[model samples]
Target: MIDLNKLRTFTVVADEGSITKAAARLYRTQPAISAQLKDVEEETELVLFERKNSKIYLTKEGTCLFEYARERIDEIDGVVACLRNNRQNLDGTIRLGVYFELTSSFVPEIVHAFKREHPRVRLDIIELDHDALEVGLLGNDIDLGLVTTLKKPSFFETQPFYSFQRHLVASREYLSTVSSTLTYENIFDLEVIASSNLLSDYKYWLKINQQNQLLKQVDNITKLITVKDAEALRSLIKKGAGIGFYDDFGGQSKSEDYAVVPVFPESKPITINIDVARRKTRTQNLLQDEFYDFLIEKSEAGLT
Candidate 1:
């Protein structure tokens, strides 16, 4: 029978692409790692690596085995964790990926509260852009994602955590110079500001608005101002840069700094959906379920 330790060594070598590096990471000798890999290859009756010019590359069969090796390793880790620890205690790391704008206010509170409740559980919170969040979720790198809902993928199960209305905002000084009532036609009259990376929902709204003559595309606005974070966008508006749409949850709290007004032909502000997602095949632990329940309770309490 092929040894599990040998498979682990092979997997580590394959992941690092160097036996020396893998040995350093695993705290084993380079020759020991090499011997383990050779034994694994011999047991499986397959040559796993191609050595050329002092470099190693995985063969076709090696690639397939590597995937199986990783899955088995994960299974072994799960088993070891279950056997070694008190299952009743809330433990293990939960990785959460959230939007950049939430880092300052909402996310910190949620993480603090959760940590207080389950002190043993390690919470890994990552602030990522929308695209990166989606990619991380799909790749199983993150356990949960908090983001605005543009288009829901069929694979993800979603829950509406909160609603944030979008409002047109500008500096008080800039608004002072303009007329009190703003129309769709006059939208171009003001310095228009918008988020740099367009979400799918934003694109949909833009397409419909442009088609209906509600908004005119201002190509020159790109040169004047561009912001990736919602908070930065609000700061720019406060600095008298330009008028832009800002989410209520993120922007409403800073209303004193800028003049916020409703935009006309108001495309329904997209719902900011916070979803708890995982691989369909994976069963959620008690801690994960409890945290999900806590979030639901918090949402119902309107703490968001």
Candidate 2:
């Protein structure tokens, strides 16, 4: 008989590329993980990994075993979820991935309200980019993903949560130094600050503006400060690092006041739809369904 715990540990080690990292993720010590790996290898009589330059690489057999092991683990999890649902249990960890701005600004309130209603459910939150959030949901790393998109993907079912505008913002101190009125052309030449993410980077911002026919009007940008996430970008912008972009929801909620003024008041503000996404193929338990519906209701009521 195969040990499922060993298989689960092996899959985590394979995914993380380091036993140390896997141990940390699985909340086990390094020696325990090594023992599990050794036991699995002995049971199969296969050399599952190669050690080179103090790092472990999966062997061909390891890769094959890992694929099957991961699938089995997911199956087991689904079965457990179904059993819990049959029992009408709503006590389990619900992992969530959210964009940075929403995580800091609005997600906490929603989470608090949800937790108040369902005291037995545990919510684990992870911050990620819009695209990374989708990947996390599809890969089963997170049970739910809160993100914003111009178009929805076919693989995931998305419920529209909130609507907001992306604004070009500058610090009041920085604006006071500049004599000319803020316009797209003038703002592009200034040092631009932006979040470093697949969807929030300077190029994506430029691309979206180009699609809106506003990019051609602005001058070529040479100066930019890319930060790790929206929170960092907001901090930098507050300190007068450079002009940056912020969503209206965050702009209104954050106390720092980034001074989000309309860049080209004539052109309509960019409209962004925030959505909560879940994998269409995965089966949600009663708890997951309830949480999802709560978010949808709040969004519709303008509560979040």
Candidate 3:
């Protein structure tokens, strides 16, 4: 029989890529870690690592085993946590992942309100960009996510909570220098503040809209300003650094130094529908259900 402890030790060693480092992390001797790996490999009849220039590397099979080991460990930990807190009414941790824009403007309020109602429940909020959010959700790193859904995933289920609109905004200072409205030719010259994923979407939209031809002659590459949060992007716009896009909900919620202008030729305004997504499963917690209900009600009330 394969030992779970041995599998765990192997995973740690593979992740750290050094037995010495893994031993330090696991608080065990290097020999013990090596022995655990040897036991696991012998039991499974598979060599999981390759030694190159005295450095350890995971073989292809080792990589596959590492993924399964990680997921299994996470599942065991979650089950243990749930069981330990089962008797304590509503006294457990809930992991929440959210998009960059909503993290600063909305999530704090929601968390505070929820915590006030259920003081025993612990909330862990992880602020991630769109790509990171998706990756975390798929990897089961978070229990729930609040984000804009551009594409639907087959493995998960989602409930739409609220909708917001995207706006094309520019600083008043930049607007004063340009013609009243931006033509495609001039739009390329203006600095474009965008998140990496948002920029990809914009490029896709431009291609579909057949608006790329007008930008061919422009020398200024559309300046892509990467921001960790929506508020950060707004701050950049307030300084008159560049024109960018932002959620209308954010713009209305905070008073900033910049002026917002609607983009000319009117690209279809994107509607951001925040969805609560989770893996489909039959086993459900009463608290999880109640929290989902609360979110649905609050979202319907438009309380933000």
Top-TM-score structure, candidate number: 3
- The per-prediction tally of clashing pairs is 0, 0, 0
TM-score of each: 0.58, 0.60, 0.61
Candidate 2 least-lDDT 10 residues: 196-205
Off by over 4 Å in 3: 1-89, 150-152, 179-181, 204-222, 250-258, 265-267
Tell me the tens digit of each residue's lDDT in model 1 across 202-302. Answer: 34555555634443344433434556566788777767776776667755546554355444535555445565554454566776667767777777777
Better of 2 and 3 by lDDT: 2
Candidate 2 residue 197 Cα shift, in angstroms, is 6.7
Cα lDDT, model 1, residue 104: 62
Global lDDT of each candidate: 0.71, 0.76, 0.75
RMSD of each: 19.8, 20.8, 20.9
Error of 1 at 7 (Å): 54
Span of 10 residues, lowest total lDDT, candidate 1: 214-223
Steric clash pairs (candidate 3) = none
